[model samples]
Target: MESPKRTRNGADVTNAAMLVDHHCHLDFPQFAEDLDGIIGRAKAAGVGTMVTISTRIRQFDRIRVIAETYKDVYCSVGTHPHNADEELDIPVEDIIRLAQHPKCVAIGEAGLDYYYQHSSAQGQAEGFRRHIRAARETGLPLEIHARDADEDTATILADEHAQGAFPAVLHCFTGGRDLAMRAVDLGLYVSFSGVVSFKKSEALRALAAELPLDRILVETDAPYLAPVPYRGKTNEPAYVVHTAAAVAEARGITLTELAAATTENFFRLYTKAQPPEELDPSLLKGAPPQ
Candidate 1:
């Protein structure tokens, strides 16, 4: 029922070619003044679906409001590593309870971020473990944010995964190939962000090229890393197309094929998110054909 959209090159991308910005922060103030315009731009670029990641569990209502307001916008629930201390007392039950909402499709933007130890390593580890437990219990994918803590992140993911299987993804992945491979070996997915589009990211691009196509996804991680050309500007979900284009080139595939694979991979992992058929018909318009 949805028509196709056009890429920057004017290629007609059907409903099936719709891209998903699997991770972003629409709740952040960077786009507060133009949130509607931002979402519209993303849709225009064929990023028909997006997930606004939660950074603090206590502020989930703000995140929830955004998701509830936008038909195609879904969210994950759990504190990010930087704010893990604030939510250290929140139990896994609460995370799982809040995630019961139809719009809450994943467990976290949680994991270790030694790059900026806003929270103690111990606290982050504890919070990360709790989130893993929540993911295991709820059957939602854990959206991990590991930075400069690959070994610890991998260890915890493997340790918990061994105890009981859970779906997970290493989001905005800029880690070494070893960590990427480790995540894949454990059946977790790796999502690239605008960073991969940087001209100096050849090493990162190499890792991306080495990944199994099905194991890859892309994001804007907006209000953060904007892809090339828009690299220094305020990032938005709309710019995810550039990141996807860069990745598609790295993988030696067309944007349409990469879009289909990543979108399918998104739905497969975030099972709580509705399939395109169940999405608002309006959002599906201009999407590539199935």
Candidate 2:
């Protein structure tokens, strides 16, 4: 009984559904040469917004500048687990202060990364807790990065939630079903990246299909993990469409439905990032015409 959804230009909802690449590092040097083109391509590909996540608190100004340079770009504040030791001294108060910037929308890409152990486990744990406190204080979502440390990550998340609930998403999730469900149980979201589109990622795709639509999100984690067809090439926000398509196929839904659900999820978690005024709000509110 619902009317077909259309964009301002009257394009079919199938082609006009907007997407938000909620996580990526626009400040990375890989994007230095073609930054303008990158943003242009992303917009052209229907990526309505992007969040250039911060991996180090010290470099937040540079990350913030990227978000400021483009109207559709936003940024997050916090240290990545790999650099946790280096920024171990950074207090929760400092993170809270940095997050006060209007352009700052989330509190972290922080959590556990036992894969590389670039930072000591203790330091990573300490830093993770700090970012959580900042997220709780600022009422902003935390972008968690958990790699090969799912158990610890879930334990920290559960322990932290017991202290106080904070909005968060497990970004670039390549974890087991248990971790995925644990995050969902905590009222957090799980974001899929290009990794989900790989040939050997059947388990990941299955997990993506299993997650509740409202608690799922999609991101590029760009200049890294480029999706299939462009697997060996540098990833960008534009390629998030491929990732979304993979997720949609996994979930037995259309790309428009996936885009609407994930975009809504992004806005729900990153409450500070405003959608573009020109976007048709109706597209986000209901199922598009079948």
Question: Which candidate tops lDDT?
Answer: 2
**Candidate 2: tens digits of C-alpha lDDT, residues 1-290:** 12223322233444847899989999999999989999988887888999999999999999999989999899999999999999988878999999999999999889999999999999999999999999998999999999999899989999999999999999999999999999999999999999998999999999999999999999989999988757898899888888888888899887888888888778777878888876777755542221
Using TM-score as the measure, the top candidate is 2
142-233, model 1: which lDDT tens digit per residue?
Answer: 99999999899889988998899898999999888889999999899999999998989999989888899889999989999988767788
lDDT of 1: 0.85
Q: State the C-alpha lDDT per candidate.
A: 0.85, 0.88
What TM-score goes with each of the models?
0.91, 0.93
RMSD of each: 4.6, 5.9
